[model samples]
Target: MSICKIYFSLFLVSSFLTFLLSIYFLILDFSLIIELNLLEFNSSSLVMSILFDWISLLFMSFVLFISSMVIFYSEEYMAGDIYLSRFILLVVMFVFSMMLLIISPNLISILLGWDGLGLVSYCLVIYYQNAKSFNAGMLTALSNRIGDVALLMCIAWMMNYGSWNYIYYLEFMKFDWIMGLISYLVVLAALTKSAQIPFSAWLPAAMAAPTPVSALVHSSTLVTAGVYLLIRFNFSFSENLMILLLFISSLTMFMSGLGANFEFDLKKIIALSTLSQLGLMLSILSLGDYYLAFFHLLIHALFKALLFMCAGSIIHNLGNCQDIRFMGGLINQMPLTCSFFNICNFSLCGVPFFSGFYSKDLIVEVMSMGILNVYIYLVFYLSIGLTVCYSFRLSYYTMTGDFNYLGLNSLSEYSFIMLKGMGGLILFVIFSGSLLMWLVFPVPFFVCLPFFLKLMALLMVSLGIWLGYCMAKLKLNYNLSSLDYLTLSSFLGSMWNLPIISGLGVNYYPIYSGEIYTKIFDQGWTEYYGGQNLGKNLSKFSKFLQLLSNNHLKVYFMLMVGWIFFLVLNIY
Candidate 1:
């Protein structure tokens, strides 16, 4: 077997082992915390610790399982590449980094994993070695770097606690002023990592990566890291901070949903949907249900991974075309791929009995019961509706609509290896939510909601479907060129100009400042006074000294006599 295959099999075996271990921990309600002293000095020591509770174990198992499947999927998707082994190695390193992040309870050790994730993900993002990948990789790295720096500041603030293990200090430091600042910084880090609100541009741009990388990134490891961090640190947040987080997350959810509704790129649409789901997870976490957030995160990972894989299959068969406008009637041509795509889409929309329903329905009900502002309530519900809206729109544009491709296309289930990888996650997409709900929430949720509120989910979904169908059925010749419509479409289609804001708007000032610095300091003052001028003066002085040395003997004797006379005069 090839090395990739060998590694894939090994990871699959490990995932099974980890799953078994997680189940044991879950059933017994047992946790094991291990701390090893990596460095020791007077009154201080650098320590590494791992927390192996059911949460960590289960999360680790899911991450490993998904990673294994992605590796398998890439075997076919990434075939014919000369650096296939290197790609697999980088992926393995990514999995290892995620495991490190999952298990570590100490902030110091967590930085190792966190930085590893950023660095490795940058490598993966730029794997294709193209200008688009390069730009996207830079955006991805630099955006996540904000979180990295925030985490570093957090570590500095955490030094006041005499230990770097945050789990031990969350309660005691909750009310401390320093801890409050740390909490804010923690939220900032989480926001950036989760691609919430202003930090969301990078997520869509990162779709320049290969589809397998997109599946892994969007599903399990990179984006969910922030949610996992907040889950681990839920005890440290104050009510005011939670309120702030709630508002920001709600806005992010609404924004991404709105953006997804107008998006056309197949992968970017899914990427935006991932952003919206992340916003949902963060909002729930802010509402003080870390378990629900984690549940949704896990469930989202399953369906979203399958969704991306199916998209990849379609794109592969469509000769690398990702524009949904050029795709239509694929359901008749690729029935299996379309079926998987529809199932995943329905799961994403939270249709009853699907994996998303168990988590999403409960989330909406819980939010309804909570003491929240009307705007937040509206945004959440509308965002939910928009999810269905875009899903149906995407389905119409790509699946059941007229065949719009200009040339003959081969749409079939020829890539069985890719299908097998997707098949592994399809099973989980259908049942993981129910399974996780049973395992995580032994006590059921008590939801006392009114009829209208209870039916709100279904109502929005129905409305979304109707709107999507109407929009899709509109004639191609219909003119949408009016200023008002164009304005609204541009705003929504450009993700409310978030890409511009985060991409160009944020970088404009810094880049301008850098140019000014180069002109004033590097080329002007530094070059004149510190470099070129100094060198020029030194050269003149050296030339004068050489001239003096080349003087004739009479001139040298006269100079010696003058010096002797001056010395005698000084002595007198």
Candidate 2:
């Protein structure tokens, strides 16, 4: 077997073993902490530690499982690449880094894993060696670097306690004034990793990576690292900070949903959806329901991974065409692929009985019951509705509408290895919600609300479907290409110009400043003063000295006689 295959098999086996161990821990309600002193000073020590509990174990299992399937999928998807082994090695290292983050209780150790994620993800993003990939990789790395710096600041702030293990200090630090800075930094770090709001540009741009990397990094493990961090540090947040987090997260959710509705590229649309779901997770976490946030995070990982896989299968067969405008009636040609796609879409919409329903529905219901601001309530519900809106819109454009492709396309499930990889997650997409709910929540959530509020989610879903169908039908029937219509279309279609705002808006000034600096300091002033002018002056002085030293003995004698004459004059 090839090394990739060997690693894939090994990962699969490890996933199963980890899942079993997770179940064992859940049954026993067990936890373990292991610590070793690495180095000691007078009053401080560098220590490495691991915290093994239900949460970490369960999360680790899911990470391993998803990674194994992604590796299996990539075997076919990345088949012809010369650096396939290197790619596989990078993925394995990514998993190992994630495991380190999952198990570590100390902030110092977490930095190791955290930096590893950022570095590895950058490598993965630029794997294709294209200009687009290079730009996306830089965006990915630099955005995450913000969080890395924030975490470093957090570690420095944490030194006030003389220990780097945050778990031990969360309760005591909850009311500490110093914790305000730490909490802010923590939330900032989480926001960056989760791609919330201002940090969102990189998430969609990162679609330049291979599909399997998208499935593993963007969908499941890497993005959720922020949500996981907040879950761990939930106690350290004050009420005001939580509210601020809620506001940002809700806005992020609504913004992504709005952007997804306007998007046409297949992978970018899904990437936007992932952003929206991340917003949802963060909002729930901000609401202080850490368990529900974690629940939805895991469930989202499953369906989103499947969703990306289905999209990958379609793109693979369509000769890399990702524009949904050029796609239609794929369901007729690729029945199984469309079926998986639709199921994953509906799951994302939180249709009843699907994996998302168990977590998302509960999150909405709980939000409804809470005494939240009216705007928060509206944003949450409206974002939920928009999820269905864009989902149905996507389905309409890609699956049921008239055939839109210009040329003959082979939309079939010929990639059996990819299908097999997706098949592994399909079952979980259908049932993981219930399975996780049963395992994680021993006590059921108690939700009491008015009938209309209870039906609000369903009502929005129905409305979204109707609107999507109407919009698709209208496009087919009429020429809606007036200037005004086109303007509005562009606005909504471009994610409210978030790509411009976050991508170009945030970058333009710095890039402009860099240009100025390069011209003035690097190429202009520094060259003249530091390099060219200094060299010219030194060369002129050397020439003058050489002229005075002329290689003849007569020249030397003349200089000595001149010096003696000047000395005699001075003496006289």
Model 1 pairs whose backbones collide = none
Question: What's the C-alpha lDDT at position 565 in model 1?
Answer: 100
**Can you write out model 1's per-residue Cα lDDT over 1-572, one digit (the tens) per residue?**
98767877888888888888988998999989898888999998877899999888888888888888889999998897989999999999988999999999888778888899899999999988999899899999999999999999999999988888888888887888988998888888888889997898999999988899899999999999999999998898999999999988889899888877777789999999999999999899999999899999889999998899999999988889998888999988888889999999999999999999999999999999994889888998899899998899899999886789866666678899998998888889998889888888988899999899999999998988987777667623322223343477667767778777887788899999999999988898888988889999999999988887788776879989999999999999
lDDT of 2 by residue, 40-147 (tens): 999987779999998998888888888888898999988889999999999999989899999999898888988999999999999999999999999899999999
Q: Give the TM-score of candidate 1.
A: 0.91
What are the RMSDs of all candidates, in order?
4.1, 4.0
Model 1: worst 10 consecutive residues (lDDT sum): 475-484
Q: Which whole-number lDDT from 0 to 100 does residue 456 have in model 2?
A: 91
lDDT of each: 0.88, 0.87
| Model 2: number of backbone collisions | 0
